[model samples]
Target: MDERVDDDITFRRLEILLAFMETGNLARAAERLGTSAVTVHRALHALETGTRCALFRNEGRNLHPTEAAQALAEVAREVLRTMAEGIRATREVAGYSADRIRIGSLYSLTSRTVPAVVTGMKIRKPELQTELVLGSNADLLQKLRDGGIDAALMAVPDAASDVESEPLFVDDIFFAAPVGSRYADLAEVDLAACANERFVSLSEGFVTYGGFLESFRVAGFSPDVVMKTDDIFSLMNLVGGGVGFTLLPGRVRGVMPQQVQLIALQPKYLMRQTIALNFLRSRERDPNLLALLAVCRMARAGLS
Candidate 1:
């Protein structure tokens, strides 16, 4: 027989051979495999034929595995184990069973929501590594759609067919001003009244920037934007140092320096942002995403 014929042995046949070897009895192996003794006997015989080598000898009503069978069984165990590991690794690379999950978010969320969610996820999955990617709301959404990140925490935008969102909380936009500004003493800011005020704002693409434009549009005139920043922290600092007044989300209230004060917009000019977790609709059932979704749900509950 050609020695290469051993390559013809299938994993299913090897499994049967290993089962028989481990249990040391045809009936016991069959019982272990949820099959009949006759089926196990036939599979063992076929395994020997496929390898073109004698692997068993009948003694009375029982069959005993030969030395060759024992050695082959050991190799088979290692092969099956390696195959299982390889499959798992492949799935992880495909993001189906990832060991690490990438999370995208707006820089503003770093203050409270992002940290809380990260801590909760780590506690729930001690082995899972979490990577936080910070960007503007539009940038984070783009990363999510491109599969550059697994999920995003941002202001929920207009719906997209490929993206699914779960709202975590709602944040009202506020007029951010320096503590000593004349508007600081007002009960609520009338944005129209601040039309001539110099403003510092997050640049285009940030959710807050969109809100800023919309709020001013509602106020019937745009404020003079003196500086536009990509970093929410820098924008807040600019406002704190009195570089200019700006429109900001409520989430930024306690995070800015004492020099910065956030006050409500007048009723007519009020705008609210719904902060949500967004991900590819297709990955909604992914295990890593499922864990994140659970953590986010708990966060929402706690906030409420």
Candidate 2:
């Protein structure tokens, strides 16, 4: 037998060989490779032909690797690991290294939600570095899509194909008002009831602001927003100072001063914003992404 080694054998053949060795059956190997059994068999045959050796032989329904296969399997594992490490190193050079997971979230979540989550993530993966960026959902989503951030905790935008979302929590929007205000006396005030009240609200780029607008639209009225700001803290400050009332999440209430009172919306058009962990679907399988996701899942469980 003339043994010839071809560099042109291709990574696909090596991958198929590895899959077959790991799975120990043609059908299962094909499934792992996302191909048909015939395709996997052909690739295996091509690998054997290129190497001038039998990699596997049928033992009843199971395919058992010959000595050559076992030897090649070790080489294949090392090659795959080296390839992965090379790719990771290259990504690091290009600044995509997963040494630090960049996280973006709304200002409201920064007070409690994000901090709690990060504390948990730190406990779980002490070596994993984290960078937390605070911004509105719209701003954070844009950052996430642009690769400025690896993931975000924010309200899900309208259907987007590029991003994957994992729901972390749902926060209810509350009607916040100054204490002893006319509306403050009511246990729950309807959207229509606040139609004439001066409002302090988030600017156009916020998810909560969108919900605020939607709630008013549903109630056959538009909010008379006297002031608009980018930060939830600013909005809360304004409300606390009696500049105007606003619709904010209950979580925001936790950080606000005592003067601001949160009341339930009547006929309760309860606007619940779902906070989700968002990441690019294209990078889902990257090892760094896997680690980040594991940390996030741990954080979510701890917070819950």
Q: Can you tell me which runs of candidate 2 are displaced by over 4 Å?
A: 1-86, 93-97, 298-304
Look at candidate 2 and tell me the lDDT of residue 75.
85
| Candidate 2 per-residue C-alpha lDDT over 150-264 given as tens digits, one digit per residue, 9 for 90 to 100 | 8888888778899988877778888888888887788788787566788989999899899899888878888788899998888888998989988888877668988889999
TM-score of each: 0.73, 0.72
Candidate models: Cα lDDT each: 0.87, 0.81
| Span of 10 residues, lowest total lDDT, candidate 2 | 91-100
Candidate 1 residues lying further than 4 Å off, grouped into runs, are: 1-87
Candidate 1: the clashing residue pairs are none
How would you encode candidate 1's per-residue C-alpha lDDT over 127-197 as one tens digit per residue?
A: 99999999998898888877789999998868688888989999888999889889878899888888678
- Relative to the true structure, candidate 2 reaches a TM of 0.72
Superposed by TM-score, candidate 2 places the C-alpha of residue 291 at a distance from the truth, in angstroms, of 3.8
